[model samples]
Target: MHPETHLALHHTRATDLRAEAAAHRLAAQARRPYAIRTRLGWTLVEVGLRLASPRPAFAH
Candidate 1:
């Protein structure tokens, strides 16, 4: 491989690694209070809506 191409690939991989790390850290920090709560709230709303409305029958 050409030196420049190799260097470019290396830089791209490094950037991707950093981005993945940042995403993981943010997810971990938010998992407890942010993501979990938001997901649970949505789930509750969905269940409530399902309970309030009957599902439509599908034609075979």
Candidate 2:
């Protein structure tokens, strides 16, 4: 293949890959709130469980 043609093809492929990556990033961003909410809910549940458990006695 000619050098110019190869460079053009490479550029096109790079652009396409960048666009695909951008799309994936956007999709993850869209789900960011849900992910955060899920993590917060789990953390609260953990805290609640800890609070409900009995404490150990300390030795004098």
Among all candidates shown, the one with the greatest lDDT: 2
TM of each candidate vs. truth: 0.51, 0.75
Top-TM-score structure, candidate number: 2
Regions of candidate 2 where Cα sits further than 4 Å from its true position: none
* lDDT of prediction 2: 0.98
Candidate 1 per-residue C-alpha lDDT over 6-48 given as tens digits, one digit per residue, 9 for 90 to 100: 9999999999999999999988987777777899999999999
RMSD of 1: 7.0
For each candidate, the alpha-carbon lDDT, in order, equals 0.94, 0.98
Cα-lDDT of candidate 1: 0.94
lDDT, candidate 2, 1-60, per-residue tens: 999999999999999999999999999999889988999999999999999999999999
- What local lDDT does model 1 show for residue 15? 100
